[model samples]
Target chain A: MADHEIVIAGFGGQGLLFAGKVLAYAGLLEGRELSWLPSYGPEMRGGTANCNVILSDTPVGSPIVQHPNVLVVMNAPSLDKYEPLVAPGGKIFVDSTLVTRKVERTDVDVFYVPATQMAADRGMHDLANMVLLGTVLRETGCVGEETIDEALRHVIPARKAHLFDANKAAIEAGKGYVSAA
Target chain B: MKEKVLMKGNEAIAEAAILAGCRHYFGYPITPQTEVAAYMAKKMPKIGGTFLQAESEIAAINMVYGVASTGKPSMTSSSSPGISLKCEGISYLAGADLPALIVDVQRGGPGLGGIQPSQSDYFLATRGPGHGDFHVLVFAPASVQEMADLTGRALHLAWKYRMPAMLLADGTMGQMMEPVELPEEHEAFGTDNPWAAVGTGMKRPHNIINSLELSPERLEEKNVERFERYAEIEKNECAWEEYRMEDAEICIVSYGITARISRNAIVAARAEGIKVGMIRPITLWPFPAEPLLAAADKVDSFLCVELNMGQMKDDLELAIRCRKPVDLCYRVGGMIPTSDEVLDHIRALAEGGR
Candidate 1:
């Protein structure tokens, strides 16, 4: 809880950046200093995109996170691209559905969650990122569990706001994936 | 202070401007930057500020020019192509030495490029945004907070210098949401313009705010007098932030969204055991040359990463003196530079000594 830097990366369609934004928003609710920056461009059409979120007890110096205490890989290329650079002891939550390849780094704890399959099984196909969020919550407890669900509710645009229950179920299921592991 | 609000970049800039005591808002709707107008539309009426959505970007800026002539405080915003439309108006404002704030939440463009984040307008914004030996005080915000903060400062400086000020932001900085703490409404102190068109009380000579001068020597004198303000802006208004550069061997130069991306790159590069830091220019026009030039002397190599081919890098070479290699790595045509991509360039600088 001192100061956490986290990067959530996945394909452009995935809510990797949204998830990062929610974390930053939740941090704001906690009155913690924070910044969230997302990558943009045509690469978003098919390739990987990520968001950098930094939560600090002090005034956050640079909004750009250089080395993250946590890395959340929601797709294969995300893990493929960022795994090698994670700081020692930094944790990673890898989505098994998108990331078929096992992680090579053994220095840090790696949680393999089939968040996509779990969300699909739970009747919410697009809640994998939330599931990953839940896994992140269980592993680090960076933000309060109760606030996260509320953060998700408040952060999503109103048009998609009604998907709350399924998303909540997906996150709980995501935690279960890691808990059962 | 008003409540801490979760606001998009454009909304933040508009509300921030109001907090800075700006009473006139003129703009046309442009993608990414439209939220500025929407927010102003909703709040300006409530707060007794004037909000005018003009027929076009040209009309909007000229309206800004007219309001600025009254010398209270006024602003206009547009995207890249739309900003191009405002350049002529900006030139006139500069020539008249009028104090005004202009925000460009730049989208991709040479001509209606794309409705995505882009720093391609770096040249258009920094290198005399309009025409005829004119300059703008261009402030670039790396995060939404800086966007809010600089918007207020832009207003204050515009009034103080009697010059045009621009917030040179891009789409990512416009659409992204962040929490902002708005200052007290009346904290923004207003300036008095004795020459304002606002009722000369029928006592003083009628004030004429004009960019035109009939005599050749008179116009040249006017241009020279205006440049004296530009020199003051350079000396007094240049701002930037440097991170971990005390011993940085490899450095990256960036601004706005590219600045944020470079931060991630610096960290990723550090994990790869490379010593790297990012220097972000908060003011695009003044360009923050001193810090960059000092780093140029310190770091073995510098990489200027942007969403464009290499515009900001051109400035770094000019300002930083390029004692070491100042290379440019970029993506374009509505594409953004990734941290990994930037790290690739940083890594090259580390290993190959570029």
Candidate 2:
């Protein structure tokens, strides 16, 4: 990756932190330079949250990014908070069912996947972040499919080992949504 | 020592302290430095060490006092405001002349300052923390590796000086990631600390670790004796590093995390054909006055940049004691002054010509 910057945002319970950690771990697996900084002030205790994921083939500068190349907005607040900060010709993946507000910008590509409805169809409400991750991997080709699978294997600790099948199914459902879009 | 691990400053200190035979750690959670307590919480049980999350900073340092009185390597850590609460116990520790390692990974503060790294506690660390004329051996480490190195050194110095020792760091130093090499493990793990309150065990006289004595004259003797030890420490334990000062006309002096920022400024100033260098004092208590005095004789001027309103600059002027006053460059409240900002001050000072 030359410069792959990701912004994942949502309310506190939406697994935004876990999704960002997986991306950072994927960068670690690829042996690339990366930084994972979370919105730690008011966004910490069950409030709206966001994390910045930056991966580079070389050393990264300051970890904070004012303009991210890709955004995965999980809620309306996140969409409203981060929509305009997307770079020109960047991608915005919004949960169509949750994020009702549409982007006004014409230069960037926006995809409304109704990801929560898709997860509900698959009976995996908690796997929304995984679905979004799969769509991001497929659409942006940010990381190879094989590398992401390997990264997911280590992201969840051994104590939660039994949830693997659900996570994989979530990824497949998200991949299917990307293809449909 | 074997593998080169990229570690945060907090985790490096926790691991190094364990290797240095410190098995008991008590701390309360504070930002930027909480990782130190968390890392110990995770690993201490596996290594048979004790990690306690105290209810308050006051309780935490007193818990440290309890453990340190037993004479095993024991420690506690906190940030600026939390450290202020622990000052009473630290004063008691000093009055009793007990050896313990207290780490202040300082955050910006007069009260609840932002959690962005700061070197604001220079005066609190170097001068006596609480009431009375007691001094702690304060060590300032500039890098993550130095965090590990100086933790081990701080433990050793606490034992040597028979007083409380502190590793004073800033939030940036606590939160940053860097590569570090741990010192090789040796046979000192089981050695008995001479002052530990490990009870005489029915073989020798019973020990009491207390700061209070009924008589005032004896307390005065303790005061004079501690000062004598301070004199000895000043003689033997002063540490400083000088960079590119051979032909430097302006010296940029900083320590803790600010020194790293100034190191960058020093390089840029030199690239712009300015004769600016940096003098970093590794130990803040001794204050490295001799080196500054010597530098004053060599250089045309000196600039001290700190995270507080001229805390360390106060010491620099006292140390140099020159006809010309030292220039102060400072930032407060968790803000990091960039290299360009510091270099601008150096340029302006050079142009101002004393």
> For every model in order, what is the number of clashing pairs?
1, 4
**Candidate 1 structure quality by residue, lDDT tens digits, B1-354:** 555766778888998899888879999988878889999999999988899989999999999999888887889999898999999999999888888999998887788788888888899888877778988889999878888999988888877888898999988788776678865565343566786888867788898999998899999888888778678878988888888787799878888888877887787788877889878888888888888888877788888888887988888998877577788988887677667788888887788874
DockQ of every candidate? 0.20, 0.11
Where does model 2 exceed 4 Å of error?
Answer: A1-39, A45-181, B186-190, B323-325
Docking class of 1: incorrect
Q: What interface-residue Cα RMSD does candidate 2 give after superposition?
A: 4.9
> Per-residue lDDT of A1-181 in model 1, one digit per residue for the tens?
6778888998898888778877887887887777676766665676878888878887654455566779999878788788887878988888888888888887888888888888888778778998899889888888877778768888888998888777777778777664333
Please list, in the order the candidates appear, how each scores on TM-score for chain B only.
0.96, 0.96
Query: How far is B340's C-alpha from truth in model 1 (Å)?
Result: 2.9
Using TM-score, give the best candidate's number.
Answer: 1
**Model 2 chain A, TM-score vs. native:** 0.93
List interface RMSDs for the candidates, in order: 4.2, 4.9
Best by lDDT: 1
Superposition error at B15 for model 2 (Å)? 1.9
